[model samples]
Target chain A: MTPEQFAARRQAGWAELESHLAQARRGALRSVPAADLQRFGVLYRHAASDLAIARRDFAGQPVTEYLNGLCGRAHPLIYRGRPVRPSALPRFYASGLPRAVRAAGPYVAASLALSVAGVLAGWLSVRLRPDLAATLIPDSLFDRMARGEVSGGIGDAPVAASLIIGNNVKVALLCFCGGVLLGIPTALTLLANGWVLGTLASSIHRDGIDYRFWAYIVPHGVIELSVIVLAGATGLMLGDAILRPGLLSRGDALIAVALRAVVLCVGVASLLVVAGLLEGFVSPSDLPTPAKYAIGAGSGVLLYSWLLLGGRTRRAAAPRLQLDAGG
Target chain B: MLPDLHEIRTADNVGIGYDPAGIGSRFLAFGVDTLVQGVVVIAALVVALALAPAGIAGTLAIALFLLVPLLVSVGYFAVAEALTAGRTPGKRALGLRVIRLDGGAPGLREALVRNIVRIIDLALGIGVVVMFFDRRSRRLGDLAAGTVVVREHRAPTAAAPPGLPPPILRTPDAGPAIDGVEHLGNAEWGALRTFLSRPGMAPDQRARLAAVIAERLCERLGLAPGAPERQWPPELLLERLYLQLLPRMAPAPPGHGMPV
Candidate 1:
């Protein structure tokens, strides 16, 4: 049959299906009327058949292209499935998250190095010229630090913990997301964070408040900073998918790396929460320096030991899909 | 000849195979997304800079300037896609969507994984380059996230309703002169009928096939080539011969409406 004739034969039904689809586009299919839902399914099947015929019998024709375009658009709606329950979050934290972070160890190490480098840069910048602290540290923040009040300046433990969690989580997420910009942003963010700490260190030294600074920071800084570095590592891992995807095409590399990074981010967020707890409560408390140092050291040792040795107990041949970021 | 039946069987046994959205559309969608991100970054910077003078804005300014944009960029895609039917601003503008391999609405987790993959693997210009190699036009993100991109065709095509003939059918004409048909065996008649019913041949090839088959049959029946009494096109003669010889063999028409 001629293309025109075939189009004429199917155009009416196609138009009807199009109308139903238009309504569906406006709202979810479940929201459509009971009558239309059944018809929509039927029409969609008919269109599928028409597409097959147009492809086979009418090769290289405009109708084939039209049907191709039509079927492409409708496939998702027609094949819509019941989304599984949204209960994977807790399980993810319990196991899937840690596995992912462990797999991303190399990225984390790189992120840590960048953060440390940033810290050294900040220290050097401030030590070389104390006046540069004026630009690096905000005026009020600088005044507080010089007055020997860094973490203690913040009031209210519970509220402070919540805010710290929110802030730190935001920072870590940014570091991870920055990898999308080719890892440059990730690197810059990590360095800037380190620079802030370095300037804070200089303030402690110049003000003769080294004891307070260490006492305030050590409690929470270990995990909080580690998580940030981990985030930057993930971002770098993602960015490497772009910079040097190796044998795999860039897309495939990105997919594999992104999955790992996201898994790392989940774990990093949990660590940030723990850190926030310390930052809010332990860091600013009037506890003795030795007690605060002990808590900080103990937590650091426990966390690192778990991260380094915990996964050895799990089966070695865990499937990558255990994380199922696509769940 | 009938085309190959490449069915995509779902759990329910009713699945239509789908083509991926063309790379051009996907690229445009990405472009739109990048543009949106750029605007967001500029706006956030401006807002943070404007708020810098306030004493409370100390850390707040840094968060807004350096941090919020990152979350916004990531959240823009993840949240928009996961919560809103698997479409971001760019995808919506270009009429594309992220769908599961089975052509289902991508769930939140799927959207999250896919976008995360986009940030990692399809970052920079890798996504566009990868489409040429992938069969489904999937970028690294789609492959990693186990998703595919499809052009959204809003119209739902219906199958033929029960008790109704498909919308179009090839006309069934009465058979031609059958006197010569009786000589051919059932197997031969079946082969001819199958060939005659098949579509998608070039006109020249069809005519040549008709001439060759019609001549051979006429020769078999002790008739002359190009006989004036046999007043029909060569293809038509062959078709008529099969139709007359095998009355029981009703070849399906070429209409694409309902499966017979």
Candidate 2:
């Protein structure tokens, strides 16, 4: 048939689909009336077939290009991602984060190893040289340590918490994004952070306030450092995908790993929020040093236990849930 | 020729084409998004400070000052893309949408991954440099997330069929005595129809195109390329010739009348 005749016959349906897509775009397909939504589906299929016919019979024509575009616009809506349920958030924390952490255990171990090596290097160097402490640690922090003031003179707890949360989250995101460069930057960030911590600890020990410093550091440092290591592991996963993408192409491997890594990063963010609150409220509070130690040790054990054991029951129950749904 | 088109086959085995957004448009979109982020951060700080009435409320302002910019910078693109099915406000304004490699809408995970990676992509202009080397103009973020930013196909507001170009006025008797019109094949007839019926052509461009097509057709018909009929405006001559050929030519095929 002539292009005109074909277009004339199908133009109404195409226009109808375009309007329906416009409505869907404004809100969603569900927002359209029930009858129109059904019609939208039929129209989408008809447009897809029309595109196929036009491609075969009318190659290089504007009509084909137009049809291709029409179908492209409709395709995403038809196959859009599932709408997020309210339970998805709670479910992610309860099971998803731990599952991801378990899957990335090796990467996390590597990150921890690097941090430990950095800490040892920093500690031994400062212990031997003593003068290196001034250069290694920031002047403000080093002076504060020299004077035996460990709280960093935080004036407002809320302000300090917000600042800590922002800084830590930024650092974590940087650690995660640094993987795009094959993970060298991610490794360096972890080492540098650990080095700073080690230098501060060594300096505080020189003044014989080691125990007091531990009281201030341990409460928040446990969760904060663990989350940082987790972020580094997330970055390392991306690097590994690039370095050794098993069967998939490098891009596909990175994409697959990134989805899981992002989940870990989200968990990292949440954990940082908790850590920030503890640092601002409990770490500098007038509570007894033992109480502070107990809070730190208790929270660390709880956090690790959750990571290791949180998702197992749900996974074990999955088959039964599926059966119940099927029945 | 049309812009670069990438085609992906759907489950139904039909190819859906997409125009990957170029570096220029993407850069503009990024600028727009950055501007929007700045505005949001500033507005949020202003509101936070305004609500503070001294005493304890002053701490809230201080907290917001520390947090709002960072939160907006990190959350804006990821949250916007996820909620809007892969379009940030800037992308929507610029007619761009992010889609997965398989041509599906991106989910929250994809959005978060890409935007988080965007931190590195923006560093030292690496994203632009990478896009220059990539065929699909994907930056490091898109490469990692397996997503592509594509130009949306905006349907014209008028509901007219795009295939039907402006109709050519018919005046069969006004034609010169063109012998051997039957010598023109389907391809030649299609060229004539497309040139005569195409919409939105500038007069000079239409004249030049008509001259070129008419010259070629005259040569094929064994008529003198510089024949007296050429003195008439090329479009007019082509129109008359088209009318004369209409009766003898077979019905135009599906591809015949449309411009590429």
Candidate 3:
């Protein structure tokens, strides 16, 4: 066959493999358990095979086939005969949930405390002088917030809420992903964020617009902060996996711990989105104090229940899942 | 060929063999062991540095030269083996054994060869590329050392022997020839002693071996088997053989022989 012909076939094979991968992704979302993982391995072997065929070359006639053909061959090898042992499921869940919680516990606690103190300080600063809000927020951002035209700051409640939730999710992701880099960066990021939040809140409180600030912040702060706390926990989990990898190799420990961390961050992000929506649409000032507290406290209870208690009572908890920043 | 019944039976008896752990578990073990050990080493070095701050540079240089290599070797094997050894913490944790082709204990030389050759196993820049392709999961180190890793079987639990009697010491007065046998040279005595002390032979078998040695000695010394056995008993026969062979095996003492 001509080189062009081989290239075309290779392209076609790659397209097929991509489709197969897409299917596997869907399968994974549906929680196909061990079956999906096996299917993915098959796909990987096929992809490898296609790659081998497409790339094979010789002095006379070309030996290699299409790139997709090489992929097709390789895909199966990646996932061959990997039977899901009964133990794997329990192990998977345990690694995902309890381990993340334990590792992130100290970081989460410290960060959460700091963030709360920051917010309180921000409220106090706002109460001290209403004009201070001008100084607390950047002039441009303050103008946009006042005009309800801010794209990224606190004013565009809906978009801001989503962005806040997204950023928090990203932070959680960084925590888990950093396991490969030995979790140092993950911890650093969490502490940095916490410090920033603390300082910002203190500055906001100095502006002397306390009630207004609280009304705007508390509703979502409850959920957003909680998510961040969980994210911090996720980072700690990754670090622990690296620091105390147990009996696994560095690579294996990183991957395993990272996967579990992904699951947690996914769950945390889902809740954060909901909280952001509540905070964005309804300013804390608009709602009665009792109502705001109800939403905030209720969400916290629910999070604790699902993460810590629900796993025992509920038969199937959605496995925590994550996608990294680069992905 | 159809599956053989005997083969099936043997395979069935073996049970599930090695359970390969995935990468995550292996990383955990490596991290913990390395961190713990690294901390201890660092602490000791810190004290050393504090005691004589001036020596810090020299000490560090020495550590780099000597300490780093040892740590690297141990860490590499510990990490790799722990990850793969039934997902346990290296050879010790897994109750598995690694032996050289000659069936000797692993020594510094063996460790050095195996560790140095790991560079080849790495293949290009890909980590452990050689291992993935090689049968038996042997990387370059294992290949160079002619070593194989196998799971150790559990020791069987059984009672002690009931009928076997303890050895008795023969009285010296029973044979004067046996007493004089100590004058024998080393080579002949060594050979005779080795032959007799071997395990699991009946009394008749030992006597027959002794007789053969006695006959040979007699031919050389113009003495009979009866003469050796009657004078020395079985125990001292070896001593007598050695005494007889020394004159032939070794030349005369310095003064008695050619001038030094």
Q: Best-fitting candidate, measured by DockQ?
A: 2
Candidate 1 lDDT, tens digit per residue, B1-260? 11322224433343354556778998899899889888988887788778766655544564436545546656677767766567788988997777776566776556666665565454566777777787777775676566787666443343422111221223366454655556775445534644565567787987787787777777776665556526676666666665565444333345434531
Using all chains and alpha carbons, the TM-scores for the candidates as numbered come to: 0.57, 0.85, 0.36
lDDT of 3 by residue, B35-139 (tens): 656665676566555654445454444333333433443345533432232212344343444443322233333343344334333436222554466444445
Q: Pick the candidate with the highest lDDT.
A: 2
lDDT of 2 by residue, A1-327 (tens): 545655766788788888887897532566778888788888888888888877765566667778888888888877766766767888888988898899899999999998987888777878999977778776766653443344545457778788788889988998998888899889999998888888878876886777878988899989999999999999999999999999998888988898878878877778898999898878877789999999999989999999999888633778898999999
Query: What TM-score results for chain B when candidate 2 is compared with the true chain B?
Result: 0.70
Cα deviation at A72, candidate 2, in Å, is: 2.2
In terms of lDDT, the poorest run of 10 residues in model 3 chain A is A57-66
lDDT of 1 by residue, A194-302 (tens): 8888877875588666776798789898888878888888889878887899998876676667655676775667687689878877888778999999988998897
TM-score of chain B of each: 0.59, 0.70, 0.36
Chain B TM-score of candidate 3 stands at 0.36
Off by over 4 Å in 3: A1-157, A204-209, A313-327, B1-260
* Residue runs of model 1 more than 4 Å from their true location after superposition: A2-50, A59-70, A77-86, A136-163, A206-209, A314-327, B1-80, B83-85, B88-96, B99-110, B113-151, B156-260
The order by descending lDDT is 2, 1, 3
